[model samples]
Target chain A: MKKKLTQFTAYFIIWLLLTWSLHFQEVMVGIVVALIATALTRDLFPDEMIKFLNPVRLLWAIFYILYLIFYIILANFDVAYRVLNPSLPIAPGIVKVKTGLKSELAKTFLANSITLTPGTLTVEVVEDNYYIHWIYISTEDPKRQKQIIIDRFEWILRRIFE
Target chain B: MSNPVAIFLITVGVIFDLLGCLGLIRLPDVYNRLQAATKSVTLGTCMILFGTFLEFGFTSGGIKALICLIFVLLTSPTAAHALARGSHISGFKLWEGSKMDKLEEDKGK
Candidate 1:
């Protein structure tokens, strides 16, 4: 019941932001839609959503998103440099790395972050082990590769999700 | 549009978009093409949408642009992941200069 209410409130707020109108009809419609949507998706979200309601976690999540934006810009430049270079410098290969995050959502976030950043695309995740296809094969040692790929994003995500 | 900054952003976005498309054609394998497509194209399209938002301000068009920006940010990488995983599972080989394939090693073990 509490979880459903929180979900409903979150959805309604987003609807309001997207609609950006205070008309009575609009508000009522937003309420109805938010309720139905939340009810439908109630079981989809794990208890993780409750943790997200905490203000501190929410702020960290926003900060992490900003950090991601900055990293993404740098990543784009890196990709552009490699692609446009005359030699076409690329040494593509798959490498295995392990993550400490236990939750499904956290793992998914890590994978998506890896893919969004340049040079790394997650090919598979079995247990805590992830098979990532990196455009530039930096190091073959799994320990070193884990430090290179997962360390940057996982620390922040740990605070937000774990 | 009228704003020089907006026009410049759009121009940069288009150039990156073109480069990403070129990568798709020039890259040797599916995974490589995905790398180019996801990073460059995602940045390019987001920049384009942001420029449109700047050009339109807080009007309905600007809000829509912002929504599209968020939507693209959320979805593009997931889509890329699905494609990359699909290709990998389908036994797509890495390029000739590839150094290692940990996925195969894991399966063997």
Candidate 2:
């Protein structure tokens, strides 16, 4: 009975705090809603053995975000310039790129990262391998392009999610 | 300087989005369609959402617009690629204009 009470109180406190800070017109209302919610579905987000906050992974995630933000800005400028240019200097091609991340989540993140960059699009991913269809493949050599993507974006994804 | 500019920007975005959807429908094959949709949709949605950002400022609606933009950026091509790859593996040939299917030759391992 004591253990059950402790669990309830713990959940109630967490919910109250999250509601208190993340969204609230009034602190008292937030607390009431959180408490009511806690009373209703107290076991919704059952406590996992591993806490959501893993410090090392979070640090790496921050680094990845910063890197991606910088790249996004660069890519935006690059795309805008190419669009405005009279020559239409785009070398469109379907290039297959490889990714080396071991986890599905990592692979997904890596694939998404590639697509998120303005000039490239992820065309396929079967198992661990990725096949990209790029707008301007800067290089004809598939191996070099694969290596570059894996080194830059895939590596960052592995750090962040894995 | 006015709501008309906003409407114009939104119209441009909508045009791009329509082209993207049209490409998906009209293209001869899946790979080509994926290409058309991914590029057009990314640019289209980003432009629309960016216009929203400018219009609404950094309020909840603007933040949601930003989030939607981020999601589209990260997910659309990933999904399209997954579909293309599954088609490739299951033996959906590229459009006849495609000079070669390099992947098939690389297969048989």
Candidate 3:
């Protein structure tokens, strides 16, 4: 019951953000739509997702977005430079990096961050390990690879989700 | 529409998009190409949407552009990851110049 209410609230808030109207009719309609949507998708909402409602977590999430955007811009410039270089200097490899994040959501977020930032593309996740297709394999040491890739975002995600 | 900052951002976005496509052709293997293309293209599209938001501040169109930006940011990497995993599992070999294959090695264990 609590989960359903949370889901409904989320849906309704999204509806409000989309419509951005305070009219009573729109509000009533959004409630109805959100209730129906929540009823249909009650089982889809994971229990852990409720952590997102915490204001601290929300603030951390916003900060994480800013952090992510910074890395994304850096990633774009790095790729652009490589693409424009005549020799096309790349040391492509599939390297493994381990994540300390326990929750599925956090792991997914970490993997997505790795894919968007730097020259790494996450190919697969096995247990706690992520198989990353690295455009530039900076070092052969596995510990260093994990440091370069996962450490940057894991602590922040820990704060947001864990 | 007449906003200079918006115009500048949109122009930069288009240039990045062009470079991403060029990467698609020039990179040796599927993974390398995916790396280059997805990174630049996602950033490009987001920048273009952000420019739209700046051009039409707080209006319905601007809000929609912002929402679209968020959706693109969330989905593009997921799609790229899925494609990379699918291609690798389907026996698409990495390029000859590749250094290591930890995924294949893991399979042997």
Q: How much lDDT does each candidate structure score?
A: 0.88, 0.63, 0.93
Task: List residue ranges in candidate 3 displaced over 4 A.
Answer: none
Worst 10 residues of 2 chain B by lDDT: B96-105
Better of 1 and 2 by TM-score: 1
Question: Which of candidates 1 and 2 reaches a greater DockQ?
Answer: 1
Q: Candidate 3, after superposition: displacement of residue B104 in Å? A: 0.9
Q: Docking quality tier of candidate 1? A: medium
True contacts kept of 1: 0.74
Summarize candidate 1's per-residue lDDT along B1-109 as a digit string, tens digits.
Answer: 6888888888999988898898888788998999998988999999999999999888778888888898898899899888888887788878888989889777767
Predicted candidate 1 versus true structure: per-residue lDDT over A1-162, tens digit per residue: 889888888889878878878899999999999989988997886768788889989999999999998888888887888888889899989998989998888898899899988689998889999989999987778889888899999989999987
Instruction: Return the clash pairs for model 1, or none.
Output: none
lDDT score, candidate 2, position B15: 76
Clashing pairs in 2: A123-B81, A124-B81
Q: Model 1: residues >4 Å from true position, as ranges?
A: none
Docking tier of model 2: it is incorrect
Give one digit per residue, the lDDT tens place, for model 3 in A4-44.
88899889987887887889999999999998999888777
- The clash number for model 2 is 2
